[model samples]
Target: MTCKEAQNLVMDYINRNLGEKKLESFLKHIRECKECYEELEIYYMIHFAIQRLDSDEHASYDIKHMLEEDLKEAEKSIRRWKIRRSYRYGMIVIAEALLCLIILTQIQGLNAGSMEETSFYRLFFQEETDR
Candidate 1:
């Protein structure tokens, strides 16, 4: 068989698709032609490597997709945590403001009480001065 014929039959030979007569002819050509033999070897290696790569392709895609989903969930969890922290901070500020308002009101009441006592002193001093 010619090199071209042998090259054409390489796939059939690899897959065991050739009949007995074609198999013998294909082998005979490969043995006689060094270039054809090398070509067959190259094709065989490529076919097997491609098959192996395909087998792992599905698993790799699955792992990649799972990781992406996990990342999204993690981001969502972080967002929720930030929202809760912001709400807590807001509530703390409101509580502190209310506490300050109460303290100011009590101070004002104290000042009003002291003003009444001062007025009594003013009236007694005026009577002394008039005498």
Candidate 2:
């Protein structure tokens, strides 16, 4: 994702409004781009502080920790999604492999059925039976 794109998502990100796919991209871009991360951090702080203003007195005092915790949870959510996606991909690959194997096995079974009734099989296997 571009810095421009990441910057644009900052408000949505802070508001917890980004979809999973968008959130993943935004987080990745911010991690790689310090500028974007700082921009996000500033926006998040201001937004969060504003939100805190309307809350109880004690809640407003822990803005830094609250931001850290929220960001950490967001990061963890992306990590969980990554792991699940990888597992799904791996399962798809396995399913494809199983499908190919089934096709090949069916083809081989058809060929063997035809081959066993041929003169070659009679000469090879019937002779063996006689021996």
Candidate 3:
């Protein structure tokens, strides 16, 4: 496998999610590519650091509450984004309907003008024919 492919699979390899054959290929590429090897090492270090935090037995009640609050804020932000998107789509539909109405009205006005012109010409010709 190419170094790029191996790098892309590094997360799966670290998580033990890759099949045996693919894992072996990824390991082989990492062994041959110093850049990928270093990148994997850095990722492993970061994973280790986070794991260490998980193992910490001392947690304050305030920290737990703070984490919950942060999660609530994230949920609120997502909800706001969804609402904004819905409003934007609603506005677009309203605008399109208004535009269609305006266009139809213009077309109706043009047809009316054409009909009146045709009627005027017919009346004028009838007078000439009568004379």
Please provide TM-scores, in order, for all candidate models, with all chains considered together.
0.41, 0.63, 0.42
Could you tell me the lDDT of residue 113 within candidate 2? 78
Give the TM-score (vs. native) of candidate 3.
0.42
Model 1 scores worst on lDDT over the 10 consecutive residues at 59-68
Model 2 lDDT per residue over 14-123, tens place? 88999889998888888789899789878878886776676644544565566668778998998898899999999999999979866765666577776555555556
What lDDT score is found at residue 50 in candidate 3?
Answer: 74
Tens-place lDDT per residue, model 1, 3-34, is 88889988886676776567666666766788
**If both were scored by TM-score, which would come out higher, candidate 2 or candidate 3?**
2
Residue 45 displacement in candidate 2 (angstroms): 4.2
The best candidate in terms of lDDT: 2
- Least well predicted 10-residue stretch by lDDT in candidate 3: 59-68
Best candidate, TM-score: 2
How close to the true structure is residue 95 of candidate 1, measured as C-alpha lDDT? 100
Candidate 1: Cα lDDT at 49: 62
